[model samples]
Target chain A: MTKPAYEGKQPSFFTTNAEFIVRSIRHSLRNVETMIMAIVLPVMLMLLFTYVFGGAIDTSGNYVNYVVPGIILLCAGFGSSSTAVDVASDMKNGIIDRFRTLPIHSWCLMTGHVTASLLRNLLATGIVILAALLVGFTPHADVWEWLAALGIISLFILAITWLYAAIGLVAGSPAAASGYGFALLFLPYLSSAFVATDTMPSWLQGVAEHQPITPVIETIRSLLLGGAADEHAWFAIGWCLLILIGAVIWCTWLYNRRAGRR
Target chain B: MGLAIEVKGLYKRYGSHEVLKGMDLSVAEGGVFALLGPNGAGKTTFIHILAGLLRADRGIVRVAGYDVTMEKLRVKMSISLTGQFAAVDDMLTGTENLRMLGRLNGLSAAQAAARATELISQFDLEAAGGKRVGTYSGGMRRRLDLASSLIVPRPIVFLDEPTTGLDTRSRRSLWDSIQALASQGITVILTTQYLEEADQLADRIAVIHEGRIVASGTPAELKARIGEEVIELLNEEGEVSHTLTTDGTITSIQDQLLMLAQQAPPNARVRLRSPSMDDVFLALTESADSNSNKEAKRA
Candidate 1:
């Protein structure tokens, strides 16, 4: 038998980070069944809202098209929470401390966690897109435009995942991470991004119309439904970038602080 | 020899409670230094500070020639710490966990895989290397945890109560691994409640009480400080029985009388004498308790 490669040798930072990422991906992949459930729940919600409550609302275009992006956004939001839960679970399990002692880049932890979430969100996105297509929802955007839209949505998911990951890292328990997820899922629905802001009270409408989700939804709707790019697209892209940057900084800071105190 | 870890007047507080109160320690290079303390004596806290995991409220700490505060990363690079709990991920196999840690420590993918295989065999975990750690026994998890620390080849390692809950066989196995690491010139700082562990493994032992080192010496030195033998006497039929040996001399018979009066049964009592690490621990800790009590009353 060949001697093991690590025999009488020391490991460095690059190898450790690669291993961290690979292990994280493998761990997430093990939950393929759970990922399917995560995808199905939102798709079911989208179907119920569009078919059962379709006539109740007048979206002008197909309600499925109007709500598909919302459902996808909801899926991303919901999926990111599990990322938090898993990260929190790892913290509680003492795995985080183990990583702290190793000679790896501290940021590799956040990267591995957020990357796993991105992979899951991508899987969920594919499933949601397929479900939408099966329900007669069509995208009129060019191939490049569609790809750009996917990229934007992915960036948005990455941003949210990091935010939730930070929450998980700081939360006292895994249950708290889940509680945070529950609170986050309701944000998109309360905004005009999902339903028309006019349907709400005038005072409430102003707030809902200006919320970040409103612009994000508006951007996705325009890109997919063959509409002119509104100022909402710029607003949405700006919102994503700001959140991404803020989340990265905040999560990195929290990780360093917490790890230092361990 | 150069010091691997130096702590001076270290203090830690959580809210109104003090965990460590002006503790001082120095561990020499390539030495096995054991910190022996009862539960809640701040062994964990002291180890945390050395590992660069926690900051002291007041004190100076240096590890591997680097100041812990100003050169945190450099200090971190030279040390590895394994806390009371096994820190392996349950979802990853033993080999995978080692490989991940290896990669994080700067190994390439192929090198990490190769290193993982080597660690697996070194830890005697080959049969279970491919299985997820969740399926492994507690001993296996602990071995994997220790294996993870070796990935970076740190010069100093901190083990806080490393054998707290292990079965006797597993504990012995771990002790061997720890000894092997120390023999390779790695400075090991260990904390444990088991006095025997300290007596057997440590080149030098520091007895900590209420977060302060009350006694520091080699096992034999501490034992010699406490004398060769401790004798306990019992009274039979209301007759006070006494025995004396040059082994442990008492200042006066009154001292023995008072101790027998406090411990003896009204009708009968048994007496014995033995050389033990437990006795030395009791004497040192008792002195510490009395001193601290006096300080508290003064305050």
Candidate 2:
């Protein structure tokens, strides 16, 4: 009799993760509606803010510069929100059970979703920035500054995508996941994305100035405008790191619980 | 052959509802073993526990000689599970799904592709191999799901109701696949609610009812346990009006017919039939339920 094929061989960690990553990327590409929304919605919002609200909010005509960072973050948020739906559907569907029975680590499923979302958002972010440039948004940053700005954007994307992945793990269904993720997209609107925090009432300023998005936006704006907001940079890094760690822990716990335990 | 799976004193509960209660079972290394039960009788739960997809509340479950809870990875390495529902990725093509699972099973990219092609043809999915699974019919999806589990053949396979929703032709095709797997010396543990399925395919059958294995034996043994034959008295409409058990001997059947002649109407016809798995299931489970009730009342 022939021996079973899997005996005496363990799949390499890299190969296993690569397979899942490719699977997720393929799914993301094939889901045309999600791909379109991730790019178009943010671009549309950028256009709306730059054209309609630009003159009323700021007479200096630099509203596009101030708003681009916020729109970039919103783009990442929109792209990452689909991770929640993807993860929720994977869980609710029977596919997760099949992965659980495999010899590889099951948490690799989340890694696939997160990595794919990060890549997709970065592409969408790039497209949104190009759209901003076309609509009179100018930046005075050097090569180093551009790289630094991109690093922050990527980090922010990674953090928020993982957070959405964790949400997907716990959501009862894909629709519920979308609803929960929608609530998080409003964070940028409530922060210092559109106008100066000083223009708001004192009661609302505390929320506008102190939230994570404000620090992140401030850091990005400073980078692109050729200034170093050192304190905001530290706060931005701190916030992204904190969210990344917490969401990773939460996702792992939720996955293990759902897959059953020893 | 040695036992491929050994389980004892398995107990599982979801809140106050117990799904598996003191279930004990074992399977030899190379044969088809069926866990026969009705819906909600915990057959799927038992299969899940054995596959290490669900942890037993308290039990000693050893698969391929490794303890399930202590060495889950090893247990996973030994078995592939085809769940009650088709679990293929609907977004990926059938070939892509198989190739991805192959890659996860440690096959190189080239090898995975080659194996995917082999399986696609083997499962008669050559024409639909490039199509997304969402477009496939239910039977086609089920075939791909089964093929996915076989990408890297494990020593044992757990099939939880593999034919539950399949048509007659698809069901027959799957039965052939199960037989082929067992013939290759891989132990197969399948659960089903269909008596004919268990009777037709299994080398041995274990009847599960209300979270316990009520009886386990070869198909013939189970049928003989009820009686060798059943004598049915049919009415004018050809419906069974009365039935009596016989030992399949001339005198035993003669006695039954004589007794029936005294009371049965003139239009009633006598028919002798051999016992089937259906009779064993109804007789065994009904008695088990009543006995448990009696024990409860006594307590």
Using lDDT as the measure, which candidate wins? 2
Q: Provide the TM-score of chain B versus the true chain B for each model in turn.
A: 0.88, 0.98
lDDT of each: 0.81, 0.90
Off by over 4 Å in 1: A1-17, A59-61, B234-272
Residue-level lDDT tens digits of model 2 in B110-209: 8788889999999999999999999999899999999988888788989999998899999999999889999998898999999999999999999999
Instruction: Specify the highest-TM-score model's number.
Output: 2
What is each candidate's fraction of native interface contacts (fnat)?
Answer: 0.52, 0.66
Per-residue lDDT of model 1, residues B61-80, tens digit only: 99998998888778877888
Q: What TM-score fits each model? A: 0.90, 0.97
Tens digits of per-residue lDDT for model 2 on A92-112? Answer: 888888988988987899999
Residue runs of model 2 more than 4 Å from their true location after superposition: A1-8
- TM-score for chain A of every candidate model? 0.91, 0.96
